[model samples]
Every structure is written in structure tokens, then in C-alpha cells.
Target: MHSAIWTAVSLFLIVEGLGPMLLPKVWKRGIITLISSPEKLLRRFGGAFVVAGLVIFYMVNK
Candidate 1:
């Protein structure tokens, strides 16, 4: 069970980490334009997902 939990956490981190790091380079101008918006909803949404994932992992492990 612990191994499975760790595997899931690791996978989540890897998948989430890759996108922001990779996508900006691939779509440099587009990413810049998107982030520049006054609303910035996407950043907030992504941050929420990351926080939720971390919280889930913490609860499961603890």
C-alpha cells in the first residue's frame, strides 16, 4: 500500500512538473500572452490542483 501511494505521488509530481517547464519553451509567446491576462485564472487553477495533490499525499502518508 505504501509503495503504491509513493508511486502515485511520484507520478503526479513528475507529470505536473513537466508541463509548466516544458510548455513555456514549446509555446513561448503563447504562454507569455496567456499569463499576462488580468484574470490569471489558469495560474490559480493550476495552483489549486498542485495544492490538492500535495494535501492528498500528505493525508495518505500521515
Candidate 2:
């Protein structure tokens, strides 16, 4: 369980790093846009991502 958790975190970090490492400009623009976005919109996006992640986790485990 611990190893699986660590592997998931490592994969998440790798995926998160790729955009900034490959296309800094695009990544910067996306960050700026996200920063400018309304709080409600950001919350919705966050909620959606969490829900999606939970669903994927269930599917994978099942």
C-alpha cells in the first residue's frame, strides 16, 4: 500500500513537471489564466478533478 501510494505520487509529480519542462511559456500562460480565473470556477474545476480521480481509483482497484 505504501509503495503503491509512493508510485502514484511519483507519477503525479512527473506528469505535473512535464508541461513546465517542455513548454515553459505555455505553462506560464496557463498558470496566469488559472490565477485570473474566478474562485468559483476554480473550485468547480478542483471538485471535478477530485471526483474524476476517485472514479478512476475505484475502477483501477476494482
Candidate 3:
């Protein structure tokens, strides 16, 4: 059970990270449009959320 969950989470993060890197223009455009009025604090917080979520998911599954 745990192995399956970890595999899924790992795959998800790999895909998420790779998608933007592979298509920088599309990703950047989307980000700009989505967070046009974004604040630095919010951006940092969003990143923290992603990292924390990934960490939690990995720890639990591991």
C-alpha cells in the first residue's frame, strides 16, 4: 500500500516539475496570466505549500 502511494506521488511531482521545464513559454504565460497581480509573499507561500505537500506525501508513503 505504502509503496503504491509513494510511486503515485513521485510520478505526480516528476510530471509537474518536468511539464513546466519542458514548456517554459506556455508555463510562464500561464503563470503570468494567473497571477498577474501576485505579491512576492504569495508566491513564496505557494512554493512552500508545494514543497510541504510533497514532503508530507513522501513521508507518509515512505
Candidate 1 C-alpha lDDT tens digits along 1-62 = 89997988899799877866878566677668777866768778789989998899799779
Candidate 1 has a TM-score of 0.41
1-62, model 2: which lDDT tens digit per residue? 99999999999999999999999999999999999999999999999999999999999999
| Whole-structure CA lDDT of model 2 | 1.00
Cα error, candidate 2, residue 51 (Å): 0.4
Model 1: residues with Cα > 4 Å off, grouped in runs: 1-39
Predicted model with the maximum TM-score: 2
Q: Give a tens-digit lDDT track for model 3, residues 2-22.
A: 998898899989988985989
For all candidates in order, the CA lDDT equals: 0.81, 1.00, 0.86
Best by lDDT: 2
- Which stretches in model 3 have alpha-carbon errors above 4 Å? 36-62
Clashing pairs in 3: none
For TM-score, candidate 1 versus 2, the one ahead is 2
Residue 32 lDDT (model 3): 84
